[model samples]
Target: MRKLFDDHKTDLLVFGGLILAYFLTRLPRLDLIPIFTDEAIYLRWSQIMAYDASLRYLPLVDGKPPLFMWATSIVLKLFPSLDPLLSLRLTSVGGGLFSMAGIIFTSYVFFRNKRISLLAALLYLVVPFTFFYDRFGLADSLLAAFGVWSLGLGALLVQSIRLDVALILGTAIGLGLLTKTPALFFLVTLPLQLLLFNFKTSGWKIRLVKLFLLFLLVVIISQAIFSILRLFPLFHMISQKNLEFIVTPAEFLARPFEFFFNNLKTLLTWEVGYLTAPVALTIAFAFLRGQAVKQNLILAAIFLIHLLYMSTFNKSIFPRFLLTFTPGLLVLAAVGLDQMSTRLRPSLLVLVFVLVLALPVYTDFKLLTDPPTAPIPDGDSKQYINAWPAGYGVKEIRQFLARESSQYPKVTIGTEGTFGLMPYALQLYQKDYPNVEIKDYWPLGETVPAALLEASANHPTYFIIYQRPDVPPNWKLRLVASFQQGRSNDYLRLYQILPED
Candidate 1:
């Protein structure tokens, strides 16, 4: 057993097996949740892409990138129906599975220890947050997969200065950027690494200058190609949103301290929630004392820079945004655990095992069973039936709708709050009912009644209202069913041209 543990090859296989098991557990349960709002957008947009050329446009929320939509477009082409919860979500699942492989490979490549890489893989596979997001229809998992690969390639280039590695690194970075605009955080850290790596080379200044020009060239070329394909849609959107989103230099200058403080707080809130103080300290300690000082420092810088960027937004910093930094944290956490594994005596194995088992159990219980605080002022009512699409209800809702419903020419679903998982679910369910009509709306929006009104005009027989009871009484609708448990609730309401009342 000791000898087996010592062999990295064996450890890698063991870890890979465990990850395979993890993916299996989640993949089979893919469409378990009701579709959430953002997922609805992606599903609808991608479905539009299936027929109309104009609908290929990028859908940006909060200045985020168009990569997820672009990827979703590709999946829609393959499946055609574009099931938000199942078909579309499967892409994320595949991306996540590959990301697990990337995590293990990147750790092995960086730390050069099978055990440490395995430890990192174990940490990633076991984390409930990681698993929850992995199965959902989102760009986070896809971005993370590419992000880890980009960072690994960049780090490898820094160590070797090989032209081929640099080219590959550049490509990965470009793809990552394409995945999410925030991936600029990784790209930002690369040149610094290049300068550090080549500080001793002949004509260091020339090398730096050449590196800068090459970086610009690669960026320009990639953007130009994507621009032509996206037809400069993203740039146009930026120009359109500039008045609303852009901050003046004077504003930033005037509140420099306050800006920095607030940004740091937002970043820390989600990060700290995921990693407790002890884990944070452990990762920090490893950075200070680890052998790969330069690489670790770069990782730390990336984490800090991203936190700083995310903090500037005035909106509430969701914990899911932390997904962008998952690869970095996972790598660092692996290093931290490896450091502990080595420093601790072999006699302490049992104590470590107990800690390992205890943590994930506690986290899973909290994530799966504990309902989130409602979006409403009164905690008695839940705004969203589920915050994310990783529960028994989510899956049940998908299957029930898939099995029971027949396709309509057009249909709109009224939902309270943002139901990110619905579009994906509809896409999957629609496979069995090709003529299904599905559109999404948040009940709080002025547009909620528009769908019901449209349905009443056409008198579409089927209605799937996520918050049926909570929908305003003014809306011409009657509830057929309400799915509720604890504080959470979802409903299905139907409407007609003539009021029964």
Candidate 2:
């Protein structure tokens, strides 16, 4: 044991430092970004699943798979006293660590260099796209972890044709598929791994037959796990909801290039924002260099096809969806960095990496300290930092209501809408507060309703509005507190409904 430790001392130190860096970025300030609309829904589902077996498949009603909720509910059950959203975020932290380990292992397999393995993890750590998701309480992080392991093991299976690798790879793909539908890309790109197969070896005919047989086993295993969803009646809703986000192949063929260029432009713009142009250049450089050409091409094809397919057919696309491609891209980028390092002096190599990684590191800093200033895509900024859907003032609202609840027999809280951030967020926060009665109101006319004024006459009633910019002065209400939702013009305003003058 002592000899083993001594032999791998440098490797241990490098990985140790990488793990420290990962936690430093992931563990702190988890509440920095407030709950999002989807988060409110997901966390609520997790809360439901944890405490009630009757509602275990609640998310399936909304066309979401139940695995992410099941995973999160375990955290909630384990730490019953922890904040609900915090528990959910910790689940994603586990997933991020899984992907980081996969990056280290897969990079070593492809390049056989310890430094490249370290560098790939470092890239995943620093890139804002990954950094943002790792700390977030979302299914995408776990889904990406499964996708990374699937690709890594698939690459190994093609060369080794081992049954153990095939079975493990199938499990990885199955978990990924349960997490999200994007795991289909794993099957779509599996054929590319054929480039790594040992066709030059004797008895190639039998080898090909064995490979196909194992591939069938993989399909059977993955599909069998997926079929568990069929026990629930709403299993078809997954495909139905999937169509809402992506265009059908026939639909795309009808207008082949209508959204292609614009979507690609937006996606590449986001890529540069998070990954940095220099790192992207390095990924390109990996191909130009002749080393590990087969592995490089396979990884590149997997990532490029994913981007191209989404760009060509997406009805709506967000940067988080691009996360599944990160492990592959970062590993490929690590290859380029490794190739460069081999030709350069140590001092020059350090200088090159620093220059290539500078932008992503700066972006991470902004995300950590001042999220509103981060260079994320506008859609992400709107969803996470600066818009009505973002839960910027949710904590403050909860605190205010909790304080008010102590003074009243039953504190009635009204929000702008019935769905999403308004009602769901407050619902999750006040799970144990039975004295609180929450209601939702929408389509506020030119003036506040007389119904509220009548209620205000008896006692002070509070209302929270988040959906719009306009506040009617004629609403017979006095402002209690107003919070700017990040840097946006949008504000979450709390008002005390006043009696008629």
Tens digit of lDDT per residue, candidate 2, span 153-192?
8878877889999999888888888888888888778888
* Reference-based TM-score of each model: 0.76, 0.95
The best candidate in terms of TM-score = 2
Q: Each candidate's root-mean-square deviation in Å?
A: 5.9, 2.0
| Tens digits of lDDT, candidate 1, 1-501 | 767667767655686697677666567646544455566666666666656766555464334466676677777787764454476677787778867887777776666777767766766775655666776777888888877777776656655646676666666667776665656666676664653464776777766666666666546644553454345435555444443543455765776554557656655755654554444555764665648886677677877777766566423445666776676777787787777776788769547645654555465444444534312112112222332232224445445455444444554443333444444545544556454556655545433355456565663433454433454545545554445433444333333323234
Worst 10 residues of 1 by lDDT: 374-383
- Give the TM-score (vs. native) of candidate 1: 0.76
Cα lDDT, model 2, residue 214: 88
The local distance difference test score of each candidate is 0.59, 0.84
**Cα lDDT of model 2 overall?**
0.84
